[model samples]
Target chain A: MVTIPFIWIMGDLLWNGWDQLSFSFVFSAPQNAGREGGIGPILISTLLIVGVCMGTAVPMGLGTALFLSEYTRHDHVLGRLIRGSLDVLAGVPSIVFGLFGNALFCQILGLGFSILSGGLTLACMVLPILIRTVEESFHAISQEQRLSAAALGLSKTTTIRRILLPAALPGLLVGIILGLGRAVAETAALIFTSGYVARMPESLMDSGRSLAVHIYDLAMNVAGGNPHAYATALVLVGLVFIINVSSSWIASRWTSCNRLSA
Target chain B: MPFSTFFFFTLRVFLVGPLLWAWAWEYPSARAEGERLIITGSSTMAPLVSEIGKRFETLHPKVRVDVQTGGSSRGIADTVNGLADIGMASRALKSQEQHLNGSVIAHDGITIILHTSNPVQELTDDQIRSIYTGSSTNWSHVGGPDSGITVVNKAEGRSTLELFLDYFHLSNRDIHAHVVIGDNEQGIKTVAGNPNAIGYVSIGTAQYDAAHGIGIRLLALQHIPATLETVREGRFPLSRPLTLVTKSPPAGLVKTFIDFAQSPQVHDLILQQYFVPLQG
Candidate 1:
């Protein structure tokens, strides 16, 4: 409780100043020292990286889940192996993922410090959680739905698409939200792979920094640290809260609609 | 078409297209051979090191210099951990950093900057200390216009902030819980743009600004200007050395790079990069 208010006070110290938290600081290009400017490009770059990671992870996660639960029998060797592998993948630390991404995506693929490299690296990090949640949602469906779909002579793919996927949409959305939260908050992996430039991402090839990295840079590298650190922290917390609440609300609404249709 | 086909198509459009696009464009080959120098540390020194790296690589086409910025502490840590060939810092090393061989590459003076619109010309060391430590919250208490003294400081783990505190003899003084910003540039921006603001940054960086959009007025300490001459003469209170540390002294390609860095060829380059070159 004490730390929470202290955190808020820290945030206000950063944003309260005209010079530190000006509109230009957020919107325009940064100038040299003893000059006024903005960080609009970095903000946009952060969002672009986050968007790519979430977009890729959601579908891949759902597909893995579907393969594990609906399509494969419990006794199948491949399904068991994949399930076990996912459990291990989720347990691996983020720094390890960063190392892997640096080697595999950045070095082998020629994607030097690009947003695409960072996002793709993040997708690999988020994939395990996505797969697990989506699989659980598929498992939670009632046996009766499967029986009824089979009775109707619905094709395997059709039953999965129209019935299982729609039924599991809410849980799948939650998985996506969770993945997004992790991706947005992540700093270590993106720091090495994404690379920090002050400009907005021009292409998948452009180097960029996420908001968390920007906050870290501001608090640690930019001089006179505390006020800017706190202010950037405030912005970071606000962003995370917005993403969390909005995703939860959207997921709940979709789930309610699915229930009504069922 | 079946809903499955539609869903697959949706997945393909959203996930596969972008993922493949990112993968193909970003990842380059990971082959490591010949001349490769990995450097990590202070962001303040990153641009400087990068410039030197660029020059060195031009001379030796086979060499590749990869520079990454973490904080100064991380730079020292990277050098200790054998993760980097060089660790760059804007401040002196701690006792822990003593295990590595440290060489002074350059020197910089930390200038106390304020907006030019403010009427105050110079601030006494005590007044500066009182304001930063929060003993004086308002600018008027220190003979300036009546406004809250918005003290901007570096975060924990920064060598620049640590050096400043030491310079002010405020190492033990509890910093007013509010003042924080990270780099010298941002501090200059915050102070130069705000009438009531006071902050610190490297004089070298201040000189790099040609437009002077922020109009930073440097404060003199105890009748001495925070100039490179005063800093070299040991008269300036806020001057500090820039050190490059390594776990082991340079050998092979790394030695060639270090020798090049210390050469007169890179001396002019250092001045162009806004840092004063070290004299033998």
Candidate 2:
């Protein structure tokens, strides 16, 4: 049943977008509101947005995970409070995050509609998921390992830096990858923050449209933009597929290397 | 040990990469060298204006025109707050928005649509009102197939819904909608897929889709055939002006861009987009 939807979507995208996919289509500037030309600027904007999202999210999510798993007891009041909020945040619909981002970042912070604001908004949205994933990975590490480190008289920070982090690397990568998928595929949150400018952004302060937003605008708003919309969707699906495969490959390779070294 | 090193290396790259890219790619005071005009609002008018903006950019290398779309109200709000230099609104400025200056660049008509296979060729305003109000539930009552009618409606806050409500003299509360759609294409697709479905959308979009062999037909409203020609000739009853709004009378680069948009140079672009240029 899960594969059915995947096959159906892939089939539809391929059937409609195969002919429209070409070198120039991926590397040229869009014309006539994305009816013609390539998605070069949109691709760059998507990358930049993801970069900002990951850069901000990784440190914060890792710190929160460490705090939850190492610095505090599971039943500690502060830890419980943090977990409750994160659970609630994870349940909050993305549109509410979009509206909140618009009010706080675009209006209050005076960032207006820019990639930086969009990235920050995305970082906020993905933090709960990232933190939860990393925390679970930390917990999956056996208590015997921690007791052994303590017996060896290693400091807490050193144990975390040299032992815990390397062991939890795969889960961290998975968390990053999952958060990345959500950030890249996002349309609603970005439409309010990053904006819909199709220009090649020269700076983070400049407004640039993401691929999802471009696909949305082309399909829903612009007349006669169906073919290009299909092509863009195909490219987006391809991108997610690549990210998933590459991350899994990295995880497997890292685990094998760890086994060989041990 | 190698794994730890590699992990730290990846961490450093993630932490420092964006900052280094931002520093290296930062333009040396590019804003001072070039003028940028930010225009926001009205998803319907965004594409046409974006095309005009691109042409304007080619003409003047030092100028940048950035167009953004949310909705007509956002356009007005942005213009009022000075967040955008210009706002694109697809409807006439209401009395509350009289302080803002508006310039009409083109015209778009709203027309009733149905599946092409349906035998109903036309409908009176009273009949449409009855169908929407649920007083007439079956297509047989409207001189069509003997099946239940599917009433498709635009979501709230869409200018199409507002215009529809105004023309029909009905409130959104009064209509019984089976399906609510966001954009013209979705509405068209719904009606096209259902032989008993009836909906309304931009005449330009409906005509384009119909010409492309989408199984949808534009129905004549009040005996006037819904065609681009009628919209161009100013005889279409339910047409609205695609206007650009500014907080005050436009001047300088803003005025120049607005003038360029209204000039005959962009008529081809306008016609290409299936919208009726203000000029004949």
Tens digit of lDDT per residue, candidate 2, span B131-233?
A: 9999999999989878999999998877888889999999999999999998888888899899999999999999999999999999898788899899989
| Lowest summed lDDT window (length 10), candidate 2 chain A | A246-255
TM-score of each: 0.64, 0.97
Could you list the iRMS of every candidate?
6.3, 2.2
lDDT of each: 0.73, 0.89
Model 1 per-residue lDDT tens digits across residues A1-262? 8899877765565555434665666667533211235557666666668768878777678778888897799779999999898899998988788878877887788776668788889999999999998888898999899899999999888888788887787677678778888888888888878865544344676677677776666554543333444544555666777877866765565656555655
Tens-place lDDT per residue, model 1, B1-280, is: 3333444564565446655654554455323454567777887877567667767877997676766776688788878877678888778877866767777778878888877787888888889889888899987898888888778887787777888888888863578845577677667767766778888788776654413444778778888976666776767778877778788877788778877887778777667556777762
Clashing pairs in 2: none
